[model samples]
Target chain A: MAVNESLRVLRTIHYDEHHYSLFVSAGTIGPKTKPGHFAMIQAGEGFRPYLRRAFSIADVTKVAGVPALEFVVKIVGVGTAALARFAEGTPLPVLGPLGVPFPIDDLLPSDRVALVAGGIGLAPLVLLARTLAARGIAADLFYGGRNENDVLKRADFERFLGPHRCRYATDDGSLGRRGRVTELFTNALAGGVRYRRVYACGPVAMFRALAELLAEAKLEGSFAMESEMACGFGVCLGCVVPMVDGRFATICKEGPCVSPAQIDWARL
Target chain B: MTVDLSTAFGRLRLKNPIGTASGTFGYGLEFAHYLDLAALGAISVKGLSFRPCHGNPPPRICETDAGMLNAIGLQNVGVDAFLAEKLPELARLGATVIANVWGDTEDDYVAVVERIGSDRRVAAIEVNVSCPNVVKGGMIFGNNPEALAALVKRIRAATGHPLVVKLSPNVTDIVACAHAAVDAGADALSLINTLVGLAIDLERREPKIGFTTGGLSGPAIRPVALRMVWEVRKAIPKIPIFGMGGIETVEHVVEFLIAGANAVQIGTANFRDPSLASRLVGELAAWCEDHGVARVSDLVDTLRTRPRPDHEFA
Candidate 1:
């Protein structure tokens, strides 16, 4: 069940030159918020960029005793660029908290799980990391970015899972290790870091690569996928992902988070 | 005082002049959490075919200026699965279900309607002849007047349910298509299904959508839809018209009705606001009251066109 909320922008926090965090006043969105669920945000007031853009629920916190929702947005196109320019107290019409959330209940405290994210993909994984921490589960975080600016929320991840438990990699060698995030993941696997389950959110290519890696390692994991969505419900059928079972699943309803076995990598 | 929002399309009567457009409203059960299902005038489900369709590959959708393009390829669980899994839920909800049927061939269309022919829950059968994604019998049947008429007549004989022919705007003369459907025994008409369009990813140096082309929908196509509906109404005076294209607000609904549509369907707007159709119902009633109109149906085809001036002849 989703509800439309006219929330006001409480504040904006710039993580870097291009990345920012929008903290909005969450009316009823607080109690309904879940990890991997997103809001269909109207970029601006008119129909120029007609369709609403989907953003993951990055963080939920209280501002001056009032519940607020935070979204980590990267300015890539007209829709995101419009959202990036909003000032404090700007009214934002949002329809959410939508899509199937990550399966956090399936993991036990003793389970050694790894939370992997690429670039802006860290948005949803951060919330999942916080939830895992609250459950007394100490999961490791492996984040990869193009550079230091791309890995926008390193402090937030370190705060959730201490500095030692968090790892980083960058393609440009401006951050921790000079390589792709998957290389860090492969290194961890090679060092006898036996992860019981892996949870990831990133680009489709990354998911495809991770799917093959997980298959070779005989490990199980889930992925939070992104698609060009119209309605964040089952009706539009606009955000469909092919399944391994020769069927198509709507990313909005059946997933935003799907197990590796559900996706047909060959088709993707 | 309660306003009479009830509307009729041949023998099929709706409680209001508002309904969800096909492919936008899924079986009327998905939005159950947002609004009351039975309160809607009608619920048009996703397009169904003789066999289950996997749809097109990924990158099937992309956003354009003031609209979106999608080549979903009419994905659905065949007619049997629809009747078995979805019809019961619609029946229990007491909704006027308008099953949108499509196919790759004429026989496929007839077969789907025949399978759903006797279902008491199905209020109407909407023939989708305008899909632009598939490589088969979609737009081919819709673009030609003779082919459209022949297909509609075949399906008309196969079902007892009221037939609503959904037309395409991609054609040069949409009015001819509308007339052809009515002449072939169509009970009503709905238009315009998305206009064929293409979008490109300049960075990738390739087409944005996987199918290379898809149907363009949303507010961008609304004006074209309104004109086509107006033209069809002038061409055929008696048939009911269900107008849809980029309709987002109550004002857009009024514009459609004034343009000669008996009813209007909310398409892409459903994605932005799941409760929009139900909300528009209330807003429409309020608007009718504010404008001193007793019934919403009275507003249809009331556009006052000015007569040609005599100075041109002189």
Candidate 2:
């Protein structure tokens, strides 16, 4: 069941000038929330920034032995800026544990999954990495950003998945590889890596390219989709992605996590 | 003394005046997880057609000033699926369901109503003639009084259920459309459907919404909605009006009640707070009690405007 509660801001960890991680007292929504599940947060005080901002519940952790939920946010507009600046203990109205989470039940401990993320897209993958770590499952993380500053929480992923398992790329060559993360993914596939299962979360442009790559490689996996939406629940029908079967699926309902093959990336 | 929040719009009596606007509420069951479905005065499900619609392309909605623009093209599960799946669940939930009907042609509307009107679970049929996204029959009939009257007459002949004609605000004189619908046998009216609007993306040099234009709804249009409700009430004193536009609080609801709406539908605000309508029901009762209102219905159309000298008009 989904929940609507006034959760207190527990902590804010700034990774850089624009990127940060927000930890909040989970109330009843923390324990049940999975990696890809998201919450529609009333970020700021009033009606100025009218709609609730949707954020993936990055991690379910603890603060001083109390359960808390972490949301990784980037300063995009007024709503997010206000969220980043909120002092600890401020009450935030959140409706949550929404949408289908990443499917991990079928995977065996020996199966290695390829996890890809770009920019703030790393939020959900962090939790996925942690979940895999706990399950004795192994995976690789391919992260990309516009610049080194945009590359967030490197040490955290390293700590969770080991330093050798994480690869980084930057658009301006200020980080690991000198190009888009998709290029790094391409290089990995070209070097005889038979990745049959891949999980990804990024902007639409990145997804368009990744869809082609996934289809070409005959690989199957889930992608956490994003769209501008008024409600994180299904009712708004605003956050929709075109499906291959000529239907529109509300990303809030059918996903945040859907099979890459189900999306009609050309139309998207 | 506890204020009686029950209200009557024509023959349909509601537990309160707070209803979810069609489109914003989906099929009503979608919100069951977050709020009590039975607490709402009524649930106006999304606009239904004869066949399931895929709606428009991507970027269907974007936030503007105090509201958002949407060009969803009246997407729905069609009438048959609604009858087979949705209506039964809503009935089980004990929700007063208002099926909002839409179509590409006049017969399409009639067919949908014919399928749903006899369900007994459906409390009313809200005929959607004002959706701004579709290419045909929606705002087309809504903009022309003759067409709107003719369409309403046909639907009136089809069913005995309480019929509400939802009006478009994208017209020269809204009172004319209001009269046309009421005169053609509409038992009640819902105004004003989203105003047609456009927003452009500066970086891409293209429309933000795929449809290029979308219906603007939210607190941004509240004043215009209030004025239209007042004008329509003045034009047809007896017809029931379901007033809506960016209503988020009890005060906004009371403003509509005083402005002549017998009831109010909470629209876009539902996106921000899913439980707002249920909360408003209790809030409205409390507000009425605090204002010494014995019956919530007693506050309807109770606005007092200053009497102006004849020379002002001259």
Q: TM-score for each prediction?
A: 0.97, 0.98
* Model 1: CA > 4 A from native: B308-314
Q: Assess chain B of each prediction and give its TM-score.
A: 0.97, 0.98
The two-chain DockQ for each candidate, comma-separated, is 0.76, 0.82
A152-212 in candidate 2: lDDT tens per residue?
A: 8788788888899899999999999989999999998898877647889988788888988
Clash pairs, model 2 backbone = none
Residue-level lDDT tens digits of model 2 in B131-223: 999999899999999999999999999989999999999999999999999999999999999999999989899999999999999999999
Error of 1 at A232 (Å): 1.1
Worst 10 residues of 2 chain B by lDDT: B305-314
Best by TM-score: 2
What TM-scores result for chain A when each predicted structure is judged separately against the true chain A? 0.96, 0.97
lDDT of 1 by residue, B243-290 (tens): 999999999999999999999999988887888899999999999998
Here the TM-score of candidate 2's chain B is 0.98
How well is each residue in A1-268 modelled by candidate 1, as lDDT tens digits?
A: 6778889988888876678998889878868988888888887778867888899989888778878988999888888888888888999889889888988887888888898899999989878888888887888888888998888788878998889989889999999999988888998899988887889988877788888889999888889888888888777888888898988899988989899888988887
